[model samples]
Target: MATDSEKLGIKIERNPPESKLTQFGVRKWPNRWGCPPSKFPWTYDTKEICYLLEGKVKVTPDGSSESVEIGAGDLVEFPKGMSCTWDVSVGVDKHYNMG
Candidate 1:
């Protein structure tokens, strides 16, 4: 987990056991999102939790040169008000929920 005064809040559990995260149930986050290799900007209006099922991505927060790499089997959390650019290197597939 990491946080910054002017940037986003992110909590990542790398390679967590599938059982631990899956217990939350897919029904809770029935929507799935996928993107081909590309870069795009996004803003989180609400806190979000996502489970990556495939592919890889590098997320760079707005105005910062720093970034985080995420891939399959990763559990990621993004706090509300965080704005960032997602640079998908190998495309992406994930299940997500907002609250």
Candidate 2:
């Protein structure tokens, strides 16, 4: 089934299969962490694929009224040039790759 993110053109896989993770070499990706209860604006210069290891977050694309909620076990892809605001309600730990 398609998620809200998918509808917005953001790709998200909820608890994808292990084979998919291995195919993507997710373990080799760099890790990032963020503290909770914070908000920040960001713009992606390149496409990014990330797998969340923990925490919850809400990302609202610029000029959009809806927000996409993400949390542990979600694998998400953000297309290049997408501007957004990240609201972290729980701390985050994740692995990410950019291209």
Candidate 3:
């Protein structure tokens, strides 16, 4: 069964499980496949787990204006009340299930 999201040329791996954004009451995607060479604009999420699957990204946590490089095989647990930006440098492909 294909979904509207699966047609985006990206696939989400379901394994790590889903999580919830306690602050905003929003669901966080446990995995996400950002388009290749795609640049995720400056946005912030209260709580989420950014897992690297097949690319590189730079994230700037809220309060602290510093961008950290995230690569494949790496996992980042962004705490709540944290605002930040994401810049996808390389391929963006991940499996994410949110709460």
lDDT of 3 by residue, 1-99 (tens): 211122111222222333323332223544455676765444323444545667777766546655666566544455544456677778776544332
Error of 1 at 82 (Å): 0.4
Q: Backbone clash tally for model 3?
A: 5
lDDT comparing candidate 3 with the true structure? 0.49
lDDT of 1 by residue, 1-99 (tens): 322222246788776665666686743688899999999999999988888889899899888889888888778889899899999998799999888
lDDT of 2 by residue, 63-97 (tens): 99998888988899999999999999998888898
Best by TM-score: 2
Runs in model 2 deviating more than 4 A are: 1-5
Give the residue spans of candidate 3 off by over 4 A: 1-32, 42-46, 62-65, 97-99
RMSD of each: 4.2, 2.2, 11.5
User: For model 1, where is the 10-residue window of minimal lDDT?
Assistant: 1-10
